[model samples]
Structure formats: C-alpha cells, structure tokens
Target chain A: MDARSLSIDGLPVPFDDGQTIMDASLAAGIFIPHLCHHPQFTPQGSCKLCTVRANGRYVSACTMPASEGMEVESNTPELNDKRRTMLQMLFVEGNHFCPSCEKSGDCLLQALAYELEMLGPHFPQFYPDRPVDASHPDVLLDFNRCILCELCVRASRDVDGKSVFALSGRGIGKHLIVNAESGRLADTDFSLADKAAHVCPVGVIIAKRRGFAVPIGQRRFDGEPISRRVDWLARRRADDEEEQ
Target chain B: MSNSEPSVRPATRRCLATTSLAGCFGCHMALLDIDERLFELIERVDIDRSPLTDIKRCGRCDIGLVEGGICNAENVHVLREFRRQCKLLVAVGACAINGGLPAQRNHLDLGQCLQEVYLTGPGIVHGQVPDDPELPLPLDKVHPVHEVVRVDYFIPGCPPSGDALWKFITDLLDGRTPRLGHPLLHFD
Candidate 1:
C-alpha cells in the first residue's frame, strides 16, 4: 500500500492506488461530509454532499480518484453554504419530525444538519404521502424519513446478496421500494441480520423493540459531531454485531 | 438560527416580545428553562406583549421570538402584527422554522381529516363539523413563519433547549448576533 499524496484545502493527504478522494481525505482525518458513500458499499455519488474542487473543477470526492499533486479544495465558505442549502432541501423534501423520531440522536441526516448549522429547510415543505411498513417481524420501515441516499439498496444488493431493496421513480418522484412484487418487506427474505436493516441513515429502518435503548443525550452524534471521527458507521456495525 | 453575521446595535435595554402560534407552547417552556438566568435576562431587557405578560397586542419591540407554525387565520394575523411591532423577529423552534409535526397534515385532505375526527369517527352519535363564526378559519396547510414574513434568525429544534434560547436572547439584548454552537445547536 504505497501512500500516494495530494493536497486537500492546502493540507497534504495520502491515498492508495485506487482510493477515491473521499477515502483518502477521511482516512487522513480531513472531513468531507457525505451521506451515500458507505465504506462497505460501492461509491454512488448521488448525494453530492462530498463535492470538492480539484484544481478548479467541482467533483464528487467520494467517486473521484485521488491523483498525486491534485490540488483539492473541499471546505470553503461557498461550498459549506451550498452544503447547508442542500441539507435544508433534504429536510423539506421529506417529513422529518425530529422530536418524535426514535432515530433522532443517531441519525446522520440530523447530525449533518447540526454540523452544517442548518437553520431551517429554507424552502416550502414537500410533505409527500409516504406509507409506513411494519410488515416485517423485527423491522419497521417508515418511508417518511428517507433521504433517498440508497445506502440500504447498495447494502442489500452488494453486501447482503439479498437485493432486498431497490429505489423507483425519477427526480422528486424517486423513492425506496421493497424488492418483493407485493411491495411489502414481509414478502421478501429480508431479515434482522441483513446489512440493509442496519444501513438507513434516518428513521426509515428502525428495529422493533429497540426504540430508545440508548437514550437521547447519551447516543452517538449527541456527544460528538459527525466530523469528530471517520468511523461511526463501522463502529455502529461493530457494536450491533457484538450484541448479536 | 444564528447563521448570518449580526450587526451591532446601540446597547440599549432591548424590548422583547414572544408569541406562540399553532405550536405546543413547549418552546416557551424552554425559554423559562433558563431557570435562574431569567432574572438576569429580565434585568438586561424589557419584556412586553408575550404570554409572560399576558399582553394581547404588541407595541414597538426590539426583538420578537416567535414559536410555532402558522395554521390558521389568527396565526397569520398574530405573525404580521408581531412583525410590524418587532424590529428583529426570530423563528425560535422547529415548528416556527420548518413547520415541524403540525405540517404533517399537509399531505392529507383537510376536509376528510375533519370529517374523520369530528363527524364520522367512532363514539359519535350525531356529530357535525363545528361551524362557529367566532372561530378562525384554518389554513389549507401549515406553514413556517418565514413563509409568511421575513425571519431574521432560525433556531431549529423541536423545542430549542433553554440554554440555546438563553444564549440567543442574551446575545440579541447585548446588541450582538449569535451563532449557536454544536450539540446545543440540535434540531431534536
């Protein structure tokens, strides 16, 4: 693993041969905020939260490969402001009731909104009608909280090999759907052990009976900002696996 | 809510007004949550036209902290009235900023919702939709305060913590604009 070096926000960052810019910067403890790029899954640069400037052009850091001598500018005032607006847009696009959400403290969307200092949604709320699916015995699927990140889709297809989740529609109409023809999670082979069950960044995929097991103020992201360390998802998986 | 750079004003004892519209009044509770610090705040500012004073009408105010979303004609009237009287208006909670939980009804048909609740629901012998003339007409959808008027600050939490409100109000009274820090800057 020869560590190839590049500069992010004028600081030197190193990467492996095939590592994307996000992998390199985050591995070096430089935070480029992202929602869709899970370390375990293939990079889907759909969220655009990790957009950074290489030389002079804007590129998604999670998908763009790191090249030596690349001058990457990730955290500028302009970029952060745009990120805040994007966070705002995500809020209004979905019905995110943070107070009532069981996933409030640990949610990446909520945490990122906090890290970005998002004041309000900054636009009129979409308030689309989304159905909650409690069809599975151990899992609960509340579609209202989804941000369309597709981390669950990637996890189910690539890691769990069940392909239990898939996204349907186009643009604002785009939404998450179950793999079953009946459009129900109970009809599919989805299980509590599947990675898809654990990958939702919002309150969409909550485990039954595990609500508020770790109380608010003591939960993850409550004590630390998202940029505090790079391995929250990995730590969360490790913790869940340990319990199992 | 404390994103923009705050311009300094003359350090006079600022007059503060507060109101709740289409909200649970939890934010006002959080404001009292400042606990003993309320006394300190009272010393620094003049309170007026709020629930704490029971004043129905607003006068000229230096700052107004608005809690909750706009859900009815009365809420609209109160919001505009506050805006006209207050120099700087702050959207003080999740409902006030983003239409929080009350806005959940936006996706549903309002008439159907009322019918289900009042007319056709269980345990109703001869129920009818209330058509009192004194009642304010409900808006078609819940709207955040900013949609109706210009909001100078946005502090986004279900009910923003007492500490957060204290920090914001103190800063405003001191003629400084504040930026809420992390953890304390929570949305939930």
Candidate 2:
C-alpha cells in the first residue's frame, strides 16, 4: 500500500513511477480489457478497448501513465457499452464468421465480446472480398478475419525481425499486407515458427492443417473465462517476481 | 395492512412459438436440450407452433424464436408469418443471425451450383434441375433472417447452448433484459 497510488473504480492501487495505467492495473491483478497492448510489445493504443476515465477524462490506459491520487474509472456501464459497440464495429468491419472460424474459441475479440455480453454483431456485415493466403506451406493468412490490431505487424518487425507484415490504406479501408513484392505469403520468408504467426489476436494467421485439433469444448476460453485467465497470469507473474 | 384485502391471482403464462426455416433444426434441438428444466419453463410459458409440439402453424404468441437463414421462397413466407404472429421475434443460432453454412455457397453463382449438383456432378441418374410450381424457388443468395425482416433479438452460435436459450427465455419471462455472459456465450 504505497502512499502514491491512483484509485481505479474507488480501489487504491500503487504504480511504478513510469508505469502506464494498464501496466499498473495488470500488476495489481486488475484485468482491463485490451487487444493491441500486449506486455511484450510497446503500447500502440490502436485498439481503444482499454480506454478508461482518468480524473474525468477518457484516455487509453495502455498509453496514459498512472498518476498519484488520480480517480480512474474502469468497468463502468457507459464504458462497457462503448466497448460493446466497438466490438460490434470490429465484427462487421471484417468477415468474422465466428461459428466457422478456426480461432473462434481462442480469439480475444470473440472472448471479449462474450465477456461483455455482446448478443450479436449489432452492425450490418461488410462481407469484404479479402483474399486468403494459403501460399505458405505451413501457414495460412486469412485476411477476412483480420481486425487490424497490428499485433502481427508489430511482432514481425519488433520481435521476429522479418518485417513480413504491414498495415496498408486508412480508416475503414485499412488492412494487413505482406512485405514481399509478390504480395503473397509464400514469397515472404515467414515460417510457421515466426513470432508474428503466433501473435495474432484473431483468426487471421493460422498453422495449416492444424485447425480444430484441440477440439471445440477443450479449447482456450472454453472452460474458464478470459478475465479469470488474465488474473491468473498476473498472479503467477507476481509470484515469480517475489521469488526473484 | 387490512386482513380483508383482495386475493391476488397469478398472471397467465406467456405463450411462445418457434420455427426453423432453412436450418438443420439444431437450434430447436438446443432448446429441447434444456432437458428436465423445460418442465420448470412449461410452468411459466405455453409453447405453440414449435417442433416439440409438431404444430404446423403459429397462433398468436408473445415471443417467437426463429432459426435458420432464408434460402428459398418458402422460408421467406414462414419467416414473415412468424413476424406477423408474434409480439417479439428472436433470431436464434448462426443460420438465423447470419447466413451460416448455407451462405458458403453464396460465393458461387446459384446457376453454377445447381449445374454442379445436378447435371455435372458425379453419379447422377437422369440429371435435371427440377422446376415445379409446387416447389419453392431458390433465392439468388442465402440471406440471414434479419436481412429479410426486423429481428428483435439475435442469439449467435452454430446453435446457441441449451443454458443460453434457457437463461434468455427466463430473463425475458422475468421482464429482465436478456444477455449471454462468458462460459455461456460461444459462437462455435
């Protein structure tokens, strides 16, 4: 219980000097819903799902540093409603046929939608004619399911050092593209083992021929909810830190 | 408090009807999967025009649960009938909410599909695209139930789980807003 602490939803939680609100909250075992703000990657603040009210101002928790004595509001009804709308927009923006998708059970977008109690894709479907890149022998890139989170792009450039993926276009037209001149995944040096392949939050990048291997009922986010898993991960990390 | 107060009577049970258009009736199966708890539900609601009762036509009902996408002219007619007969219309399961498996053929031309299935397909005896006035004409593309008519609610899943259907029905009966939370909300 440090004296310098910010109150999130009236609960006082201490933060390191330079830690973002999301970082502080995660460290304190508070699960704020997010997509693009992975712990291993720098906070891009692209996905606005982690937006929280700090001292009566709405800001992305992943980018905004936690300040002492600040009143931050997370999990409010209004905010949850906004998040639900955002999820709906994402659902319609892409051809996210969750029932037929390989990543449906493990998808963060689908999981968050479930956690938020989004009954349906409230918005109309776009049904974009995006191409599937099954050119790679071991991997497949289904662009139709891409939410434009850019996690794969970030992971490819920052972690894998391949720079295999990048975002193209602007606004609603913005989409993921391959780095190769041929605009095909087969032309790129992307392997099944690349960090980018495993970092997708949705069903965009999948290992070929390995779909539905885990079975529907036994998959991630099937038995336990995503919030519980996040809390469990946070606690495990905290225990590890204490040991070190 | 007066001892001679008027005796209160329990409100009449709400009537509910359900139908499947072009679906596999999996959504209806999920509804039946409510199992022994359906007896408890029976106490609160009167089911009409559902597959369980083998009712062909829907009478006037409070709530209508519709499953499947519109693949043919007959589906459209039944869907419109459900809309007219019910107060609140709920599109249940993936096919009803979105053009589920049937919509997969949406990418290809309907004529091409018919040709491949009938004339060009392997092991066809007297291959012909049947054209009869009595048969329902296939639509150009599979359409979700919402695309054809206004749907009050949508339950998104290949087939929404029995628990999901039960909770939704009970919540509606209780005059509470229906919602599916995690562990109960799945699309596959």
What DockQ does each listed candidate score?
0.65, 0.57
Q: TM-score of each model's B chain?
A: 0.92, 0.92
- Model 1: per-residue lDDT, tens digit, B73-103? 9999999999999999999898998788788
Q: Which predicted model would earn the best DockQ?
A: 1
Candidate 1 interface RMSD after superposing interface residues: 1.1
Runs off by more than 4 Å, candidate 1: A1-3, A233-244, B1-11
RMSD of each: 5.6, 4.6
Among all candidates shown, the one with the greatest lDDT: 1
Residue pairs in clash, model 1: B1-B154
Q: How many residue-pair clashes does candidate 2 contain?
A: 0
In CAPRI terms, model 2 is classed as medium
Q: How good is the docking of model 2, as DockQ? A: 0.57
Per-residue accuracy of model 2 over A1-244 as CA lDDT, tens digit each: 5558898899999898989999889988887888887777788898899999999999999999989898999989999999999998897777777878888788889888888888777666666778798899998899988988888898889988999999999888798999999999999999877777777788999888978888887777898788877764345322422321
- Residue A48 of model 1, lDDT score: 92
Report the first chain's TM-score for all candidates: 0.95, 0.93
For residues A1-244, what per-residue lDDT tens digits would candidate 1 score against the true structure?
5667999999998788898998887678888988887777788899898889998899999999999999999889999998888888888888898888899888888888888888777788877899899999999999999989998998888888999888999988999999898899999999998878887878999899988888878777889998885765434545544542
